[model samples]
Target: MEISLILNNELVWDKEFKSCKEYVSNLKSLAPNEVKMREMEAKFLNLVNTDKDVSKYYKIGGALCISLLTNTTFAYADTLGGVSDKLKTIVSPLIELLAGLGYPVTYGMLITGFIMVIMGKKSKGIDIIKWACIGYVGLQFVPFILNILELIGRELRNSL
Candidate 1:
């Protein structure tokens, strides 16, 4: 009888076997380390799955990286071995929209500070300094609000 097992969307095993138990026992005898490694992997996966904050960070980080790559005109799709063009396009626009909302203000302040220093406006640079400080402080709030809104938008889009 032939049995098959798929892992990570790949056909990892497909062969004739007398019995599942025998196959397992043979695997255990032949590759004890493999079994132990698989068990450890499963435990780690379970831990990640149970941790809501960790999962959220993973999702957000992945989305942010993809967005950053797309916005910066990098070949993110090709790098990932050609992920769907639609997904690449979607991430690019979402990143642009988020940036358009207010992100540029933060960068603008930093640029202004640099320009003020270069223009020999040592005393007037205080204003740019203050703006940079405010922008840094505002960053803490911006990410939280944007994350919440992104979540809501994703939910609404999925619902539709």
Candidate 2:
């Protein structure tokens, strides 16, 4: 009866849903006056599916709602930009580190592992160690094996 939605590794909404169609119909009904709110909610849902940070979406959506209520666009214009800027700042450091390593594949795998670990921790409580271990094995170990094969291929090419 209760549907739980984990957004950005945090529990955003957990409530009972009678039926999926009914829920969607209710959402559609809310779209007329609060179109921005609906847009933000939909975006938030999509971000959750993609394992992205939903906090940024919440901030942007909140700001947009305030703008709609007050008939003031200028005040929240920079706020929307700020959300994007903050996201860039958050990702830039990791990207730079990955670039510096020259083996971005490993870094990308590590990032995926980290995100999975975070999500596991949030959803499953303190027992996230098991989830993290699984993620590491799947992401890191699989790629490491592939990298070894790639190295062997390069060596064979050089010999030929």
Candidate 3:
């Protein structure tokens, strides 16, 4: 249950914390500048590389958890109120990429599954074919689902 705090490539604090909140508070108090914060960030990166023990201790949010470690304005994100169009613009590339890859993969899977059926793996082949068709239909529905969500969001935003 020992924690080592490194600053400027040297260990400055080595002790045990009774709780994760205490550890986080101590960490926040220990690193007050960009350099120290960067060092702390590097330590976290190293922890991510070595083991997932750090994740067990900090079980809050996703990458947003890193923002809580800093007070800089740039670390925070704004509400999605004014960014609907921007979100669509960003997601367009993903939808395009999905459409580009979807057909070929689905067809390939269908052909492979048919081959497996001819090769005597009947149940496995049928399962593969079923899954491939399901995936294809789900992907085909993606744009429609997103459109419905967009419409809902628009109505909510307009009502507000």
Candidate 4:
């Protein structure tokens, strides 16, 4: 009979089995003969090497595998943590100073721009307001952008 695994009102898995032991046995018997496995591996490699798109995907998969394997060691990460601690000691105060100043600058520019526009100096006022708004939004994204760049750099370093 068919066996089904349901979870949260969804069919998670469905298979045919005579008994629970048979299901467990089938799961355990996943090994293939060495000669057949080698032949299949060779065939897969040949296919990947011969096809440009497949080769690109294979290279990407290989790079990901290499990155994952290289980053599994904590020794390098501990050194980075030490460096980051040093950098934080130096840069954290500077960052806080800038953040403390940025909001007032943003508000000042916005208020001045609106006042100018209300006084009929429309063109320059609108330009200043637009730039101030853009700067405010851009400042919010700085941390997100830095995080993305850091992730990219780490992956590139690992792949290399």
Candidate 5:
């Protein structure tokens, strides 16, 4: 179902708190438990799934939210792609720097830890090696983690 159509039928989805006073008043109408609130959410998901034009509705909803938040018109259907491209541009330098530095730093740490261990500072060497391993994995694994998160978000959006 179109978001506006649903909102027109039930104001709960459109209920934005205007003030502490309004929030207090609305509290009385709130679902008693998380399950009740989730049932409403399920109804929304079902409606969107049954609606043939849900994608168009999503574009309008996304635009409206972006416009409201930024105080500007932003109704483009390709907004997500545009944002992703911009993000890649912004993050490219950081990724390049990480690729350049991570390997050398990791190797250096490992070598230093080995030297320390050979000099009988076993505890310090092990600590250094542990930190180096963690840092190297984190540096290399960030993109994979982000990919997983993006997949999850996409699935949720598609479900809607």
Candidate 6:
């Protein structure tokens, strides 16, 4: 289970190869494809599974994973409240700019597109209309998308 435990083991080094010269010639008193090799492997696995140190190793690993998840959960627990407030403060100017400049431009595009269509520029008008629709939806629907994400976060936090 641990490096020190295996390094201190004498039989392992004795049975294992030392170098190229010893590897080709030495067999550690055991023939190639010995009958008991499979049984030895199975028993070694069984021993490892039942070992006290191995249990401790698994317990430590599980504890570390749980600790990490718990810490991360706590770290992001206020994502929809405290973090959101700070993020809102940081992004307020951008939101204000979008509201102040984006809607009027989109509305102008829509009206221009309508006029262009009536004047026989169908393709250009359609493209302008499409872009105006996209802009309008981005301005209006983005908050709903954000709310959905906040709801999902709240559910996960509650379940945890």
- Compute each candidate's TM-score over C-alphas: 0.25, 0.18, 0.47, 0.47, 0.46, 0.41
Q: Could you tell me the C-alpha RMSD of candidate 4 in Å? A: 19.0
lDDT of 4: 0.85
Q: Which of the two candidates, 2 or 4, achieves a greater TM-score against the reference?
A: 4
Worst 10 residues of 1 by lDDT: 73-82
Each candidate's root-mean-square deviation in Å?
A: 21.3, 29.2, 20.6, 19.0, 18.1, 13.0
User: Which pairs, if any, clash in model 2?
Assistant: none
Query: Candidate 2's error at 127, in angstroms?
Result: 7.9
lDDT of 6 by residue, 1-160 (tens): 1232245555343243367667666665457575688889888668768998976876677777998988743233564567878888899899888777778898899999999999999999999999899988887877788889988987887898
Ranking by lDDT: 4, 5, 3, 6, 1, 2
Instruction: Report residue 149 deviation for candidate 1 (angstroms).
Output: 1.7
Which candidate leads in lDDT? 4
lDDT of 3 at 9: 100
TM-score of model 5 vs. true structure:
0.46
1-160: candidate 2 lDDT, tens digit per residue: 8889999999999988678899899898877657888899888678867764566776678888998998887533455336756876798788567545544554465556567667765444333445545554565465468568767876776687
Residue range with the least summed lDDT across 10 consecutive positions in model 2? 121-130
Comparing 1 with 3 on TM-score, the higher-scoring candidate is 3
RMSD of candidate 2 to the truth, in angstroms, is 29.2
Candidate 5: tens digits of C-alpha lDDT, residues 1-160: 2232255566544333367777688888874888888999898788778886985697679888988998996434566746877888999998899778999999999999999999999999999999999999898888899889988987787787
Give the lDDT of residue 18 in candidate 2.
Answer: 75
Per residue, candidate 3 scores C-alpha lDDT tens digits across 29-56 of 8767998889999998888767777775
Error of 1 at 25 (Å): 41
Model 6: colliding residue pairs = none
C-alpha-based local distance difference test score of model 5: 0.83
